[model samples]
Target: MSAGLRVAGVDGCPRLADGSGGWIAVIIEPGNAMKAERIDRLAELVDRPEAPQIIAVDMPIGLPKRVGPNGRAPERLVRPRLGMRQSSVFSMPSRAAVYAALDPRLPDEAERYRHACSVARATSEPPRAVSRQAFHIFGKIAEIDGLLRERAALAGRIHECHPEVSFWAMNGETALDLAKKVKNAPHKPGLALRRRLLAAQGFAEALTSPLQARALKVGEDDLIDACAAAWTARRIAHGQAIGFPTPAERDGEGLPIQIQA
Candidate 1:
């Protein structure tokens, strides 16, 4: 593998429509297969390089500071829950937080909270069904918590897995914020650079095969997340490290974290 930064974009539970049911796609390079695999695959890919720089994911990496109403406000929030099994509810809040934290500007706390709530509502099944599903998959509510804890644990593991690689969670909000800033800026060399970034993302989509696209079905949100991840990776390759925001710190609108490598 080349010594240059190796970056991967992960989009999980990507939906095809407004309703429930979506798939996950891990786009390593343009036109790659959208295979269903563990997040560890990302780590594995980065490890191939002597010192991979970054791996950006679209899944949630943290839990809410406090649970919402309805037994866990975040849990109750995922929108379309039609065909989804109850077990998926366990991943909702963290996913929302992950998405929210990736954005640079969220407008305000209310916007951030609303966005989180909306994501939760969209991903979760009905309350009773989710409770039953959790029991079936985990044996009890406590077991569900265990699963959640494990998911959160990955935040620390990203660096450990590759040692040389840093991880970031990218979401739609961050992408939009970045785009706005880049697009609104006065005509300058930076505008061309921004367009190049978007072009790379589009190239990635075009390179993707029909079968892969069908399988991954990268949606609007997923595409934006992937673009942000790609942009972050590009920055890392150029010697910049991207930081993630904490749920409390995000006002729900601002520039995404820009970290130093």
Candidate 2:
């Protein structure tokens, strides 16, 4: 990679003991060296002195006001491409529902979840509620959503990516046979399969190597996924990436809804 070019792959991490969960970024900089960093806010990573030119993050980016039976176009388009791994993509609800999940007035998590579901059911066709997995990342979804809304330029730099989608592209558009997690726990075979793909993409050993405390407060899967996201970021930077939809779609707020890899 050129010294002037910098890109990153970012993924959300589990909350630590003190309830501080943020984002993990695998940055590819000059000399093709990889650097891992923990950021409490996505903006922190974006505004750093050596900020990446492109950031591929594993999280939902656009939010629609009302979703149809197939959900958002991006989700609908990419799900089938993953085959058995399609379940990894969660159906996102309406913008109102996502915003409701972070309602400051509803301090109780259970209450907020119910309220968000109620809003989602009303805004979606065929009436669907927010899934627990989707609800859990609403904060992250909201974080990037709000930032993009506040500064439209970042939307051009920060793109939405899914690990499976990135890996699928890296694997010659073939979906992997294994699931990264089973019953909510890491699966070694699946993780190893992804590492091989990353290694082939020119990711350094520091990233594909065995897990260590190199980047604290994040799971092994988070690091791998981030690297996969970074792989897509590299493609994106080079104009070689493809969006889920042939042409990117947009939300009511004008944010691009396509997942690029």
Candidate 3:
């Protein structure tokens, strides 16, 4: 890889008061300078001028037709290594379930959630339903899934990554002691721990600072998560990153089914 290659780290963000939500991205340039932006669509990141060479996104990829007991291969492989943070890993349902959940005719979110769970239970081996956390992000998952299926060229550049897994890799392959949130609220100690880890990876205060993220409607935790993913993107660009499974699996659509960090 050229020393001038650019990479990005991205995480889904909360909706604005105007009923719009999207992803937050941290684009790391050649010299480590960063650009943080809120993009309303995943395509915006991929289609922008000077698009990133590698995109390490905190979103699920590669939906399976029938999920096994541990969900997809990647979730099962990395969850155990996360310790308490394992809860952050949601078991992905089948491709049909995901597509059904995002059906425009569903009317509302609650209806979509219920409909998705019904499909999920029927498609999963152990008859599992989708978690609320996971269900909420089905649209985001669908966005990337559709993008990969449509643009074969992007399949290699855009990768699935989890912040906790990225953080675990950054913390010398050990899980962090604290949770990023408690009762759905940010935990300062945990955020501090993550910031320290990112700093150790050469991230400057400007990129990781909470105040800078707040103005953009991006949560502090999310900003930290995006930075962690960017760290993984850097490692990947340098051929230093590793996938959850020793060898990545593939979905029916041929999308890679492994999380890399």
Candidate 4:
């Protein structure tokens, strides 16, 4: 393994308004024991010689279509595998909806309807309810859009992934059904499951090390999620990672809309 080929995993702090809410990243070499860290700005953080050869993010990359209010193919393809926890996979609003949500004059419902309508009409998608929770991350989504559109080198290196999907792949192995994000499980069962899986892959330090723990800005779950994403990043670096849709669909700009886990 050369020093240049690194893999990274990233997760966003959901509620920040100014696009500086915070982001956590875990980096590991393809064949090394472990090399992980948390950072606030993902694009700027990895802009160097040691930048990841592959980056798997927990946010949506390719958005849904607006042809007719239809939802994103990636979310639709992945939901069944999650079973009762399908709620974890929300419909990605169309690019138009995202831009509309950013307008200062639009109220919450009006903006959401605008997004729903835009995605459906432009992409021929079915009208999917855009959740307020999903709308909240508009800022973070915008940040990634800026990165990909501007940086030609990062276009394919950074992939869209889901931590929930990754957790299922790690814990279940079969991919038919998998783990949950544990919204409020006692003793944090979801976190524990994710930690145990990463620990098995030599990432115990990423979870328990004092230095790493101090770097976690959000809650324990976010830290755990970043680690899970790193585990998936390892698989991606090793050519073992699998995508949700074998033949993924792409947005108008040609970015893939598949979840790799």
Question: Who wins the TM-score comparison?
Answer: 3
Which 10-residue window in model 3 sums to the lowest lDDT? 15-24
The global C-alpha lDDT for each of the candidates, from Candidate 1 onward, is: 0.34, 0.88, 0.90, 0.68
Q: What would the per-residue lDDT of candidate 1 be over residues 2-111, giving only the tens digit for each residue?
A: 33434554444323455433323233432322222223234344446432345544333333433334433322432122122222335324334335423458756556
Segments in model 2 whose C-alpha atoms lie over 4 Å from true places: 1-3, 18-21, 213-215
Tell me how far the alpha carbon of residue 57 in candidate 1 is from the true structure, in angstroms, after superposition: 1.3
- lDDT tens readout by residue for model 4, 188-258: 45555666777777786545443464454455666667777877777777778888787777778777778
Compared with the true structure, what per-residue lDDT tens digits does model 2 show for residues 78-170? Answer: 999999999999999998999999999999999999999999999999999988999999999999999999999999899999999999999
In model 4, the Cα lDDT at residue 48 comes to 75
Q: What digit string (tens of lDDT, one per residue) describes model 3 on residues 70-105?
A: 899899999889999999999999999998889899
lDDT of 1 at 26: 39
Residue range with the least summed lDDT across 10 consecutive positions in model 1:
160-169
Candidate 1 Cα misplacement greater than 4 A, ranges: 1-3, 14-23, 26-53, 64-197, 200-205, 208-212, 218-224, 234-261
Candidates in order, TM-scores: namely: 0.35, 0.95, 0.97, 0.81
- Residue 34 of model 3, lDDT score: 83
Which RMSD values do the candidates have, in order? 14.5, 1.7, 1.1, 3.7
- Error in Å for residue 16 of model 4: 8.4
